[model samples]
Target: MKAFDIAIVGAGIFGLSVAKAAHDRGMRVALIEKDTVANGASKGLLGALMPHIPSQWNDKKQFQFDALRTLSEEIAALEEATGVSTGYRRVGRLMPLYTQDKLDHALHRQDESQTRWRTAETGFSFNVVKETPFKDWPAANTAPLGYIWDTLAARANPRLVSAALKAYLEPRITLLEHTKFDRFDEDAGLVHLGDGSTLMAENLVLSAGYEGFDLIKDLTNQSIGSGVKGQSLALKLELPVELPVIYDEGIYVIAHENGTVAVGSTSERDWSHKETEEPTLQAMLDKAIQFCPVLEGAPIIDRWAGIRPKCRKRDPLVGLIPGHKRLWVATGGFKISYGIAHRIAQALMNQIDATSGTQIHLPETFTCAYHFA
Candidate 1:
């Protein structure tokens, strides 16, 4: 029976972040993965770190804003410690405004961002402009009214970030790859593995993406989350790495530093196959090429499909499992997992250590108490 200070079941971004945070605090952490790390949605192509519109802000929105703002520093630290680049660049984002109503809403948010989108160290803008920074990036015809160049939005290569995290963690933590979690023995503080082995830990963290909900349901008899399928396509086309991510509707076109452009994705609640590319991706590709003529004939280098964990409340489910002293959860990040993962780790670690008064505040809506209710 191996022992650890903490045991995390899942090697997705959320679980990896938790394991890294726990290890950095000088704790023996064991990370158990059913498959490989970043095998699910975390490995997806689109790494758009766009924040919510600055109007009608609440604790949830503020939490996301803080995560987006502080991610750059977090990525820098990860890169420095591992000597690997995460392909992170704050290249901003572009939203083509085609309707007068939409442009009016953007203008209102632009004014609201002056106060809502500001931190003590820096501020980001959400300005509406008639011209794009690049020609035909988003053909002027797409934005008959104008475009919103949101300075806060950024992009990261998801694969590179995962690789950097793996590099930083592989040497420090116990990684149980290709191992499935059977169950957690709360009374014994033991995590039962599918191989009939058990690892002892003072605490157990479940960050297994959508499959995590099944574990919780088995324990508490409630379904709090389900998997939402998303598909993305990577193009061989090369564009300037600093180009702002062009986003319209559900389509995201982001140019990475590796000289590849990523376009995606479809949010389907009912997916027939988890990893099969369907016609929805083609439709999105067509629309993306329409928005950016430069992508019209760009050959797709890869097509990816994965399931994103979406909570019933539509926010991340974090914090300690109610009625269980040794169990914790950190999943249901869905689309914004990459942007908010580090902060989620901070909040969960703070809870585990009973260390409060930190700048990171987990929203009430993200709690298991809230989700269980």
Candidate 2:
């Protein structure tokens, strides 16, 4: 049996982030994946890193805010190390206010953003403007009142980010693609693989998207999470690479650097299989075109659908599992995984590395014990 300091199940953004953080700490790590890397929801096209409403803030929101605030530097370092661009940019986000009530609500947040989004050096704006910076990026009629230009939001190419991390960690860690984690024997401190191989690890992390929920249930006899199906598509359209992400009524239109704009996604909880419905996908495309007329006749380049894990309490479930030694979890970021996975991974590492003398306090709600409770 191979020996490792830690074994991580899942190669999605969450698992990959943890593997990188652990490897950086000079720990021997093993990343096991049932499918190929980023084969889950992390493979989707829309990568909107928007923040929650600035009002009624809480620890969860603050944690996400700090994560987003530092992600640019993190991506820059990853790119420098691997020479692979994650296509990251702080291009901001746009939300058209269609009603007087909506516009008033947005106006109220401007002051809140000025206060909450401020750091010692800079602050992001939640300004409501009369028109978009570009013509018909969002049709003028879409916002009868005004639009929200929030500077706190940013974006990255999810696939590229996954690639960069893989490139940086491939030589530093053991990556077992096409291998499933059958179970673990805590008594023996070994992880059993589907191929009947066993590996010894001091610690184990289950970050296998929704499938992870099943593993947790088998171990704990409780339902801690569920899977939500999301569908998104890519359009072959040329737009300014710096164009702000357009978000309206649950539809997102993101312009990527490769001249292919992304439009997505539908969150469906009641689904049986992982398949895309043409109507659902077309409806999103039609609405996207309504917001960005330039995509009126754009050709569909690719379509993607996958299940994303949603924890019981709705926040990301991280940290050590209560009542269990050497068992941990770092999954269930759901829709916001791309924006905060790196920080979530780091916080879990801080908890795992007791000798480091530094701890990152996570929101009480984000703990695995909270979900189990």
Candidate 3:
């Protein structure tokens, strides 16, 4: 048997983020994956890092905003170390305001964003712009009330970023691909593998996404969360150098750098099979073409569907699992997982950073214990 400081299951962004944190903090880390990295929900094409509206400023919102602020640097650092790119860009977002009431609400959010998303060194802005200002996005005409141009929203290729992190950490940390984690002995810090081999660590984190939900159920015998299946489509379209992500109605028309626009996704709560792409995805594509006329004749290049974990409280589930001595969980980010995975991992690291004394001030409402409270 071999030993390390910590063992992480699930090579998705959440697990990789925690491994990176522990490794950076000079701890021995072992990351085990049941499948290939980023093959789950994180492998999709839509990497929208949209921020919460500044009006509803809370710890969860602030944490995401702060994480998005520094997310590019983290990806860049990993890219530098691994000689790979995450296709990350802060191209911002364009949310159309059709109804007069919605326009008024956006204008109010514009005021709140100035104070909520800004700092001295750098800041983000949300402005109500004329349709002419959007020289690149094609959906401006669909918005009867102009658009809300947010400079903070960004996008990154989830697969690229996850792979980059895995590559960088593969050398620094012990990574086991195709290694399934069975039930664990949290008190003893031991993780059992499917091949009948055992590994020991000082700590263990469950970041296995939806599968982690099942693991927790086995341990606590309580229903803590459920899976939400989502479907996305990638469209081959010709566009200019870059443009902001288009958020019109409930559809997202995202344009990447390589002239490929990705339009996603359907959040199906009551889904039976997550692997199949149903006819509803085509409806989304049709609606997207209507919303963005420029993509009228775009052809479908790829289709993706996966299940995301949603905690009972609906926010991210982080920190130690309630009543467990050494078992920690960092799953259930839902749609915001990519945008806030780094901060979630850091928060978990803070819980284990015994020598730091000063821990990251996570909002009390986001802690795992809060669900029971």
Model 1 lDDT per residue over 36-120, tens place: 9998889999999989988998999999999998899999999999999988999988989999999999999988888888733
Candidate 3, number of clashes? 0
- Report how far off residue 325 is in candidate 2 (Å): 0.4
**Clash count for each candidate, listed in order shown:** 0, 0, 0
RMSD of 1: 1.3
In model 2, which regions exceed 4 Å deviation? none
Which window of ten consecutive residues has the lowest lDDT sum in model 3?
A: 132-141
Q: List all candidate RMSDs to the true structure.
A: 1.3, 1.2, 1.6
Worst 10 residues of 1 by lDDT: 353-362
TM-score of 2: 0.98
**Global CA lDDT computed for model 3:** 0.84
Task: Kindly indicate the candidate among 1 and 3 with the higher TM-score.
Answer: 1
Candidate 2 on 1-373: residue-level lDDT in tens? 7899999999999999999989988899999999999988889898899898888988998899989998998999999999999989999999999888988889898878887888335667788899998778788988888799888899888999999999998999999999989998877899999999999999999999999999998888999999999999999888888789999999999999988899999999899999888999999998888878889888998999999999978989997777789999999999999999989988989988966634667999998768989
The digit string of per-residue lDDT tens for model 3 on 163-251 reads 78888898899999999998687677788999888999888899998878888888778778888888888888877546888887678
Candidates ranked, most accurate by TM-score first? 2, 1, 3
